[model samples]
Target: MLLETGSVVAVEPDGLWVETIQRSTCGSCAAQKGCGQSLLAKLTGHTSYLWVSLAGRSADDYHIGDEIQLGVPEEVVANGSLFVYFLPLLTLLAATVAAHYGIGREGVTALAAIAGLLAGGALVRWRAYTTRHDSRLQPVLVDDRQVVQLVG
Candidate 1:
């Protein structure tokens, strides 16, 4: 499980809307100017928001501005990254190879690769929609009682 602490921005019936600030160690890094992470951090800004499931705890237990710990399964991130990235590349390669050898046309092969990439993207979108509500994919409250901070 990967854990992060975020401040509750809003309380929902079944979950909490948490806001986390993205911090980078760019100031301490030697390659601050050259690192891709540094560039991304600059471009993406510092704030991120996510919905965290309550994990059977009552919403009444939390209030706005309360800091809480949330966890996401490591395998979920790894598997999701693989499925999202590799599927399109594999499809594109397969289509390009088949078109190159079977049809023996350079123009047709390029078009086939483009078509395959689009098909793969469509599949990814469909799968994401289907699994949007899957519990295994959601971040869960790590501890119900361990409030990091409470604002009265």
Candidate 2:
């Protein structure tokens, strides 16, 4: 599970709305100083925040301003990334190959590739809509206890 710390911003009947700072991974890269990603991050500023749903916990158990930990399964993240990045490319390749070998026309191959890419996108959208409520993909409230303070 991947865990992240966030502050509860709102308490809903089914979940808590948590706010987390959006940090860029570019800072850790060796070439960040000259990378376009680093430049873009600088222009965008670091103050951008992500609001996420922390579900599977009672609203009574948490409150606004409370610090909490949220967790998501590693498998869910891996699968989602693969689906988003690879599906369209695979479809385009398959369509181009079929068109080239079956029809032997460059124009037909280009049109088929375009159609395949669109189909892949539509499939992704449909799958996302169907699985939006899947419990395994949703982030869960891992811990809500505040850090202990030391007194001098």
Best by lDDT: 1
lDDT of 1 by residue, 1-152 (tens): 98878889999987899975435445677887897666776798755688887766678999999978888899999999899999998889999999999999999999999998988888889999999999889988887365444457
TM-score computed on alpha carbons, candidate 2? 0.68
CA lDDT, every prediction? 0.83, 0.75
- Please give the lDDT score for candidate 1: 0.83
True-structure lDDT of candidate 2:
0.75
Clashes of each: 0, 0
Compared with the true structure, what per-residue lDDT tens digits does model 2 show for residues 32-72? Answer: 78866467667877433334543444567778888777788
For this target, which candidate reaches the highest TM-score against the unseen true structure?
A: 1
